[model samples]
Target: MYTLLIADDERAIREGISRSVSWSDIGIGRVLLAANGKEAYDIIMKERPDIVLTDIIMPVYTGIELVEKVKDTMPQVQFIILSGYNDFAYAQKAIQNEVKQYLLKPCDAESIRKSVQKAVSRIRDIEKKEQFIASMKENVEKLFPQAKEQFFRDLVHGSPNTQNIEAYKELFNVHDGPYRMLLFRIDDNDYVKLLTLKSLVERNFGEENVTFCIIINTAVVLLTTLTGFHELSGLVEKTQKQCYANFNIEATVAVSSEGCISNAAQMYKEIRDIIRFEFYLGEGRIITKDDISVFRNDYSLDTGIQTEELSAAIRTGNIDSVKSITNCVFNAYRMKGYDINRIRACGIELFIIVLKHCEDCEINAWIKNITRINECNTASEIKQFILDFAVKLAERTYQSVISSQNRVIEKVIRYVHENLDDENLSLQHIASDILYLNVDYLGKLFKKETGMRFSQYLLKVRMEKAKELIKASSGDIKVYEIANATGFSNNPSYFTQVFKKYTGCVPKEFRETGKQEEKDSGWLPL
Candidate 1:
């Protein structure tokens, strides 16, 4: 639907056109009548009618002049010229004012309708084009930020593009000057909290001065000139405090050295590399180029004898030795400021070494400690876990070692008692044939466990068995039988010598003394 305005100096002409034309058929919703061009111009301004039909000659303003005034203000308003004279000048003036429809006077009702319809058609076309342009502009506005973010990311990671940098800056609305990259490493992985932190940082530093993207964590491409490079330290510190107080997060900021927009890739690389030092510097810190320069070249891990030393300590079940070696390893890493991954790997290596030496202990604690070690963000935390783990492992190993040595000594003693009649029962036979252990190691271990050498323990057991056999036997029991029964095969005299030395009497005399003692206490022996 469209609004149509009819204007003429003659009241009849204006009223006749409004009445004769079936305005609705011509897509005219309302027909406004103006007696002169001045009145029509006023109506056009006020009503903003879609189409205007006016005569060339009017009392106040000419139709041509009205067209000229309205066209500048509302180019979308289509104009139709009505002239009483067949004059080329009037038609020429209509054409000059961009009036598409020119109708001479005495035109019929059908002709006026056709001309108004043509104006309506032209108006519809103009509206469609305008609508398309508005829609396109709306979509572009929505996508503009995303495109700008991608451009910033490309500029940060890709090769330097100094050639068209100015045009790019204009396109992306980036201020031209020195730039720096700030990477925030958030301890928490909650994305919503991360975004909140980003918003907080952007608020502290104006949004236009920084472009942010979340890659692993938040990365900020700061326009140093816009933010004032000298003021960055104070702003970063303020943001850090806010992050702690508001978000309760430990966000460590790694800042690159001052650089141009062209070398943003270098700046990003520098900041990323600087962030890795947080493992040594501890978290929730503002690390800058100057802060890390001294240790930048000192990244090699000291993988010398520390691992071997720690392993040996754990094996020996020495808690103090284990702790000392653990301290040495961690101190070396802290001094060199090794890469965090390398340090983690070293920690894992020590964990494996501990696991290797462990037997019959709670393994889950060590496995959980591996995760704890990996999750530790700072050197001190990892060192503490390793130290505690090593110490506990040493204690467990010590208990296991003691329990195992007791069990082996018990087996050796049981074997000697079980095989005493063999007369070949010896520590060497027990170690090699029964227990399958090194003779020297078993000997020293036996003495340490029982306060007696294996051989001495064996002799004591044999002599005790001999005395028991002789005393428990009847008086008819032979000495040789008693000797053979007590592991002295076919050598009663030698057994007697050993038995006499053990009990201060020969075997026969010992038996006779026992009988005599029984006779003295009672009337007869059973």
Candidate 2:
């Protein structure tokens, strides 16, 4: 809605115009009245009405004077001059002040309304242009970040859109520079913290000198016109300390040497290469070109020999040996300054070698999963990937060998062999309390594999052990001693009965004669 102001020395004329104008039809919601030019100027200044109608000659200030005062300050405000005299000078002054509407005194109500309708139309047009400009600005703000990231990416990749670096310099407001690039490898998943880290850097260095972009997981900061390396380092130190203390996140920054904006690609590459050293050097510290240059060495690894040794360790099921060999391989890669691709290739080769040695279908399935290897972007992740594969393969390989030899049956047999002297040793005890398996299922499986029920196997094993003890004693060991040695500590009479039933003679006869009728080992009575 628009507002209008009417000023006339004659009160009746002012009232008549204000009351008679159908202001709502003209889109004027509020109509104000002023008796003279001074009052009109005061009301205009306070209310900022869209249109002002004033008599040409008045007290305190003339209509021409009021228009002159407001024309420059509020050019949007439209003015209409009313006069009693048909004078050329007044009209000329009004024209000079850019007042387009001039209404003679005693003008009809319809004429006034028509003028106001035109003013409202002009006001609507201005509002429409302003709204359009505001929308454009909002869209520009939304797209600014994407454009900025792409530009920085181009600079880093040496594919800047324009060879005229000066154009970019002007466009991004990058000042004269002996610029240095810092790549921040932030260990954070929180999106807000990335922005906070950027803000912290900008605060440490002035905002104008810093251009920041996030490329993948790293944040690229371009610092222009730094005072010195030490000062930059101090600012970086502050930023790191504040970031951890405030956000509980660590950021490792890689700093590049001094260079110009034109050399930004090289500077960026220098930091980009060094930033990967964080996996070896650890996080939350700054890595400079000088620091990374020391890591390159003449150390070399024999990939084929290392692969063989690693596979052998997995086959032997020695996890410690596997881990030691794996660590040595990664350390060699680091010392030799292998790139990420070479490291990943080494990992894949090691994985494939181990998988080839594993006969277990499950291990084969696990070793064939190359997604984890491809997902590794750093030396640490790659090392961990291979180490995890090594450990799993070793465990699975060991389990496979045991399973092929009938692990459950072997475990039961070993237990029986070791504890034949214990009266409490039984398959039910072993299954229910020791190995946590159901007794019935264990019995069925054991008999299926060993071709004898658990009780029959137990009796045969005890009888065999008793005969060995009797023979080894050369008839000097007593009957009770023989029984106690084979899980019958108190019942020597029952031991004698079973001994005679199995060997067709008593323990004493077996010890002295070393011979028996050997009727199916006489072992199936139980």
Candidate 3:
């Protein structure tokens, strides 16, 4: 439903319009009324109503003045002027302004309803176009970040077509530089807030003398033959003020380390270098070429003592400490505008450091499952992986309780395989193999890893051995005799039950079906 505004100086006209029209029936739900042109303009700016029905002459400002003030800003708004004096001059002025219609005051409800319906239809069409663009962009985002950035760039830079005209760039602080680039930012977006930001810059900073293409949702590139740095600063500084005053937005502008020739793509990369300053300067703000500087120093993830301490922690899975260090590293780079690929590469580098001091076995295999594919394609992806693994590994390791369980997991797996025939074995059998861990605690670990009771694995193993004995023999044998030898204790009836579960048949039937006696070889799964 579209929003409708009724503005007039006369109380009777306002009340009559409100009471006479079935606005809800015409797809307008919210109705705002203003007593003067100034008040109506305030509503139009704030609420951005689809239709405005206003009296031609009002106390503070006339409908003509209202149209003059707001039409350029909101050109799509449909306006119908109302007047008590049906003078030819008033109608001609309204027609010149392209007002939808000039109605004699106290017009019938049917006349107003027709205008309202037409306005709603126009709004619906605009909404459909917006929805289609949003959906198409949404699908493209899921493919990859690089693809998403390229799509945004192509959208703004590509030609509109032979049948269409393109809007000119509106430069604010930009000057006559040899090359120009735009930095677009969508605020508060976990998703494509970037797109909104890009759109805003195109509106505020575009110009005919300059040609620009969006490089990503968050930035654009413009190139021109004009030259002058002072003029450039003037343009950016002014654009900054208008953005906040007009749109309630704050976006950062980054000047390239050096301006490029009038090549759009090359100029884009040159400007992109300034993005590195986003870390030191921060996001949601601008950093220009002057803001960035170079040094002869080189630094890796490790910085002397910090590296030493962090590497040691990662080696032993002293995860809480590792988490603290990982945070420092990721935050430093992420603030620099590095994407996930850079982040994950840092993660891999840290892992390598950890690997230097510790065995692969010391590192949790579960972490390998999580980093799953640590192939770093971009800075952002890598950074994200590091951030994710750093936190989770910390939780798994230094949550303080799991460390003992880790050892117990390893020890029990070794013990179970070594003494498979000992169905009499219990958690107590594990105490000597892994020192300093309790029997009850050991039972928990055994179950967590092997997914069976400690006693259950032993029983399964004995049954497995019994199956082989039955199949290997050419001579007849009873199940009880085989059960006692394979450590079934003294329960003959239970042994046959356990054997049936493992082999999916009664022992006698299983032995008979395997009449190609020599063919029944190993007891493992096929």
Off by over 4 Å in 2: 84-88, 134-150, 159-168, 186-209, 213-216, 219-227, 235-251, 277-285, 294-526
Local distance difference test, each candidate:
0.76, 0.79, 0.63
TM-score, model 3 to reference: 0.29
**Residue-wise C-alpha lDDT for candidate 2, range 1-526, written one tens digit per residue:** 8889988899999898988877997799999999888899899989999999889999999999999999888999989888887899999999998888888877899998887788788889989999999999999888877877777777777884847667766866766577788877676545677778877777778866566545444363655467377987888889889998987778799988888777778887788767766755779988897786654432112465776788789988888899988888888888988888777766665665666554444554674476688788998897887788679878887777658548888889998989898888898899988788899988988988899998888889999888778767755788888788898998999999887777778776666564544532565654
Candidates sorted by TM-score, descending order? 1, 2, 3
lDDT of 3 by residue, 166-272 (tens): 22122122332456555544233333444444444555555564444344533444443334556766666666666566557665676653454223445555456
Backbone clashes in candidate 3 total 38
Error of 1 at 269 (Å): 1.1
Report the C-alpha displacement of residue 82, candidate 3, in angstroms: 72
Output the number of the TM-score-best candidate: 1
lDDT of 1 by residue, 274-305 (tens): 77667568788888877876654454334547
Residue 149 deviation, candidate 1, in Å? 1.5
